[model samples]
Target: MTVIDNTHQRLLPAPAADVGRLLDRIGRPGDPLWPSPTWQPMRLDRPLSVGATGGHGPVRYHVSDYRPGRLVEFTFDPRIGLTGTHTFEVIDHGDDACVLRHRLVATPSAHMRPLWPALIGPCHDTVLEHLLDNAEHAVTGTVTDPVRYPWQARLDVRLFSVQVNATSVPQNALLLEAALPPAAGPRSDLADAYAARVPPGVTTDPQAWADAIFGNPPPAVTALFRLRNALVTPFGIERGDRSAFDTISRTDRELLLGTDAGHLDFRASILVEPDDDGVTVTLSTHAVAHHRTGRLYLALVRLFHPPVVRAMLRRAAAAAVRPRPVTPPGLPTTTPLR
Candidate 1:
């Protein structure tokens, strides 16, 4: 038998079950190590597909052991360059929190382990940050930025944790789409393509842009649009800016680079509304689902969800309309010296 091991720990302000769900998100569904979208209702014993999205190379996963509120272990193809089994565990602290741990028994091929220090090292840190932030958000109402953590570790196993804010869902389609990666295209080409779909004048003003994207959304929607675009076009106010942008609300709209880790579908919507507050705009931030034209047509529901887009529009409108502090009158006009 092969032996490999490593570990990290995080103290979260959440119960074991909630912590377990947060851990599940660490390795995306259909990740090379865990191939499939569906998590088993009971312990996973046989091989299974962890997710259904396309773009994943062929791989197999087997869930070997599970203990409610405690531990889960699984094995899968590590790809040719990587090989391993993964374990996710939770240790109760006898309070409102628990310690979450992840361990991987991996052996990299000749080229991978050496290069991993530089390549995977940084991303592993990012993964940990993401886990903690996601956990805090899951447990609390505030959204914490994932860039705060600075600890780094190298191990045959990976571990991450965070205090999650409790979130509820009513089976809306938008959340699923938000979980996907973004589409890809040349910056100019993508902007041009999206611009073509954007009606004139609307892209000029942040408020108008919101109106154009959402069907007369609220002022908050306008603010959200402006914020999201601001992130994309930090310097230039061009509608064709190509920078990748992300929206992280319960419902979100994002323009992602294709080179990102996961596969994505492309979808969008534009709407306009008129009111005293200004035109409210709503935009769809959905990617086409990896599945369509299959025997399971119900799967299409999973493909094109847009609720998050709506929610983002609402928030943007609120942020857009928030009162800005007025600039005090400038000092008396200065006379020009001859």
Candidate 2:
């Protein structure tokens, strides 16, 4: 029966009343305090009333208490093995400064104890500190001392972050369907799409994402491409070069790139479209096999394609918004920035 009582507080430069005004808008769109999209934004069904129900990420909770501007407390859903409440409090400090504090008081279910200190704890700390950073940024227009995520926490973030999922190639992904129009009906050799969440300020334009994704690719992805390119030399083929992929088409919300070789023809689309909360960035691919070897190669590569594409998109999104790239501890310096 282990208990947990964790607290994080930040001294804001504004008066309690002023900070409270910011607190009141916690779950609203463009929420200034929850450090959203990067982390799941706190959401409530309606405004901040006692009984409003919602939770950020996988954790579930509902408002148990609220004081217009002074405080807000949420009691966690017990089925998740956590019992108790977490809160955000605004403390008056006589003059032009106030303390903003977040405290979590809970007892984990027996099975949850083991995972808390390792996986959950680091992530919790990371989220709260960033929340506080957001608060400071809201009050002062900038965060002077932002939290620096440790490599392990970075891994945890990449592990638990919003998932990328297979989705319909959106209508806006104009190039996905346009690239191989001849193969559209039944002969389409390969077509796939995946979407990832993007936060408020990250680059939504495909060109910026292209730079981040292609310019500084994940280490494993870069290595995979290197091997892929090397396999083509003996065939006297022009190796696929990510940096050299031509911009085949463009729209306000989409960018298309592709290349051709003796055996393979390829095209990909990056679509940045707005969603209610932030943005949905989709990566859609289209390809045609020009030879039996090309068909075999694409079939083999399909087994590993989704995960690789997800990693690249997530890395690009992170580079667009994170203060600094966090590489896993043992990764080599020769690898891309993320």
Candidate 3:
């Protein structure tokens, strides 16, 4: 067994109590401050308390201790090669300042020790820095120098040929894959949520859904897309057509949307199917580059594609599960009798 220990700390211009509040809110799923694009918003099954279990994705732990406004500690449950304690501690630095420290002490089995230095360590360091930066921003109302994913951290992202093929193949390919909670109702609920946000005439058909959301994009996404195109325009890449979603494709369980920009042809599809656990939503894209410049543009798109799709799907899932308000009886309906 090899012991692996790491610590990271940040000084914030805020009271200890304030810093503690910010720390307590860490590890939420979909939190913007979490640096890692894949694992986000670590969620606990219950409120913070001793004996409660929580962690993100596959990393599960039991809360061993907690002191309000000061400390929280979690003990790992023998995962792979890791077993030990992780802690967050807050120290007071007078009334106007405080320091927050995160410590991890683990014993890694022989096979895992080598992985620690080469892969885990670098990624952990990047995440810690971002966490501290978020803490400072929450408490101080400013982030001096925001941490960005270094090349090493980006390289740490796990990539599998299977995942790529699963998402990028098939006509009107589904590029993003996700599973929603069984209680979220059904795929149609998610489709409705997405459909509600798209422009008029965009339907839930898989192909059209994909085109409206990806090819044409909404205003918010279009802005970002335009900016990216502007940066690469000098290199011969053309801007996307904002009117692409005006066309429609309808199918039983699949929808396809396609567009041509410069020397590349873009096709996207959405397929929703029910499964034993819940519904599976797939958003996929297939691009054909006719020349070198189009290939270059496609490469950049592929780099950012997964994270963007994940984010969009996550948001959709959240929206799908959100409880809707029920109007009480006797209230006037928004419709009049004919």
- Cα lDDT, model 2, residue 186: 73
lDDT of 1 at 293: 29
List the global CA lDDT of all models: 0.38, 0.76, 0.56
Off by over 4 Å in 2: 182-185, 198-201, 291-307, 317-338
Backbone clash count for every predicted candidate, in the order shown: 46, 0, 11
TM-scores of the models, in the order given: 0.37, 0.84, 0.53
RMSD in Å for candidate 2, one decimal?
6.3
Rank candidates, TM-score, best first.
2, 3, 1
Query: Could you list the CA RMSD of all candidates, in the order they appear?
Result: 20.1, 6.3, 15.7
Q: What is the number of residue pairs that collide in model 2? A: 0
Show the lowest summed lDDT stretch of 10 residues, model 2.
329-338
Candidate 2 lDDT tens digits, 183-223? 45475567888887755645667877666766788999989
177-254 per-residue lDDT for model 3 (tens digits): 112224322321112112122111112345433443454333555566768867876787765555543333545676
Quick one: best lDDT, which candidate? 2
lDDT preference between candidates 1 and 2, better one: 2
